[model samples]
Target chain A: MKLQHYIGGIEGLEPSSFEKKVFVQPWEERIFGIHVAMMGLSSHLEAVKSVPTKFNSFWTWGHLRQGAEGMNPFDYFKYRYYEKWLGGISGFFVESGYVTEEELSTKTEAYLVNLEAPLPSGGEPAIDAQIIEYLRVGDTPACDVEAQPKFKVGDTVTVRNPPPVDHCKLPGYLRTKKGVVDQVYEGTYNYYFPTGDGVGDPMPIYNVVFDSHDIWENITEPNTKIYVQIFEGYLEDPE
Target chain B: MTENVDRETYSAARVRALESLLIEKGIITGETVDKVIDFFEKDMGPFNGARIVAKAWVDPEFKERLLADTPSAIAELSFPRGMAGAEGENMAAVANTPEVHNLIVCTMCSCYPWPVLGLPPYWFKDPTFRARAIREPRKVLKEFGLDIDESKEVKVWDTSAQIRWFVLPERPDGTEGWTEEQLAAIVTPESMQGAAKVAVPA
Candidate 1:
């Protein structure tokens, strides 16, 4: 689908003059004052700037500094938008929507600090950190070549019931699915990385088969099937 | 697609602006003038990939190579290539045989093989295609006038992610010993996606 469709019709908080006043302060000054005082002072000014235009333009800057110090500057900057806005004296950026505090802290520490952020939010940070670190060290050797396919064609397995998380490749439509292994395609490559960027190294992968009923759950035809060849990165050990 | 506007000056100006940006960014080096001249002179696109498929139809060995490693095989034709030196994903060339034909679809998003195939069709990018392709590939093919016999197996490949797929359609008969050029004329983009079959002019 067009990238435009994905970002379609989603408007966020309009930048007020107060935000402009807050943003105009020198970058260093804001950081310094915020770090020390933990107070935001600019909240009343209003301005009309196309948020999407600013978001797109800001992304280019982040891309320019790609992989710098093992940092995904884009996500870091995105979360920082939330942090600075929320932590800003004018108002909190977290009021916008969808972006969580845990996501903000996780990406910040992973990319900005360059150390494994102790994931207090359990698997979310760990997974985020892993993806980022994997992207940083592009084209690395397979970590678990032996943890390879234990199931072969004709083997029946149930797709693990995993909780929904934001910004995941696993489409909400398909979760906790069960399907037969139609064909065990080998040497497939998984592209998932810590940075959540498509720009990363490819890793070993596999393909699984799902009967149409399993995927859609209410399909009229029981025989129909959808064979999806995903990289090993997306799958878990058969339960 | 015919030009709707007669504003030649406006059209030329936009092209010039884009060319200037490309040149300033060092995207193309050496004789840049020749590249611009060539861009208009020749249709540089996935049609070249269509031509390769046409050639493979007449040559068995080429067909074998195409199925094995489509990236290297099509690179021989020198289509407008991409920066990814190595094949980034599963760039497979599945041929449509007389008995079994291959169709391409992306249920999630339009994940195309841009290196081999140029810009995708408008429908491929349409939400209708993304939503319907997986659920009703046969019905969609029928709408495209591709009626598959029940005896023949039709495989609709769902390339919703990174792996890019392109179909190598079965060469239509009646053009016996037809030259690659002649066969290529019959190869349409729809044929490559298994939505339509190549046919000789009646």
Candidate 2:
């Protein structure tokens, strides 16, 4: 599908002081088309995870993206080629009901404000402000309030080897690096719905530092150091 | 004691009164105002570090020091103090190349290297660009109307609120013997982000 169709929905929102026109080129159009398609797939994934049906196309698409090694014709059809079309269908399912702008705004505001609300113990609470915002408008989660870190200044620990496959907050560049805990900063408990994980306060992640040479690999000077700070999810118990 | 109490109460009351007046006057627009105030409250508001990046690009020793010890490099500049809304001794800057340009996007949220590159542009904050930029950076750059030579590498930095990065563009051409001031003239925020390159216009 063409990229213009993705942003076609945003045209209706009353332009506010914050609104401005952003043009797209062909390459960008394709990228956005992919992104919007992903959003639709992610929403469907949530739906399928919560309530399974022969309408399990979202899970099938996610599995294909994961490249889950298994027998799968339906997976390829739902995710590999027709994902965007299906995603657009997912978008329609979401925007089906009548919801007022004020209600939407109120919901959006709540999501943005309490972005890091924690997950309930044992039970995954399906409904959240961020989810509501994501379903109604394609807005993703932003700065969270509850990401409080646990490691202390000067704690020598190693980053976790590989992040959890399903969902993660860690970036790939920082995986498996070692460093001193420079400082402990607070993080909020905002749930990133796409991956379906919760970031919160009580167990805030510290910014662990790794030397520059270790991170970049190409540094010629052994003494040449590039320090990188990482969150807790990226770290594991240093052996 | 009574006078002191009265003064305190009066100041508090005055602040509340002004807040109400602003809201009544539409001077304070809902959560947007709260966000602005919150931003100010958090020391790492956008523009603070940008000034430092602008200054460092000119100073060779500062650049050296920044590369050496980023926090200390930033401390060399005054604005490094009180960096709110982030973790660690937060200081980082990424250099751009002639062949490839760099731009930052907070796909998940507006996670920026505030100390180096100040506040994000309106477009940077837009969900449209933010979401698509990560999934397809080259495509996004093409949309910005940049036609990078295929041979030239295009590296896109996705700062996922885990760590912040700043892009330092290749110094503009025709600067064979130009001073830092002249060099800095073309090193705009856009140039640093790789969306645009630094070229001394003829």
Give the candidate number with the greatest TM-score: 1
Residue lDDT tens for model 1, A11-97: 232211112111232232222222111110111101112111111111111121221212232433343231322233222222332
* TM-scores of the models, in the order given: 0.55, 0.42
Best by lDDT: 1
Q: Which ranges in model 1 have alpha carbons more than 4 Å from their true place?
A: A1-154, A182-192, A195-203, A217-225, B1-44, B75-89
Q: For residues A106-166, could you state the per-residue lDDT of candidate 2 as single tens digits?
A: 4434433443332112211222222222322322222445543556788887766552445
Per-residue lDDT of candidate 1, residues B21-133 (tens digit):
22233322223333322331253346666787888988899899988877677666655433121122346778888777667766543456544454356556444554554
TM-score of 1: 0.55
Evaluated against the true structure, the overall lDDT of model 1 is: 0.45
Q: What would the DockQ be for model 1?
A: 0.04
In model 1 chain B, the worst 10-residue window by lDDT is B80-89
lDDT of 2 at B7: 34
Listed per candidate, the RMSD to the true structure in angstroms reads 17.4, 18.3
User: Interface RMSD for every prediction, one decimal?
Assistant: 20.1, 19.8
- What is the Å distance of residue A65 in model 1 from its true position? 20
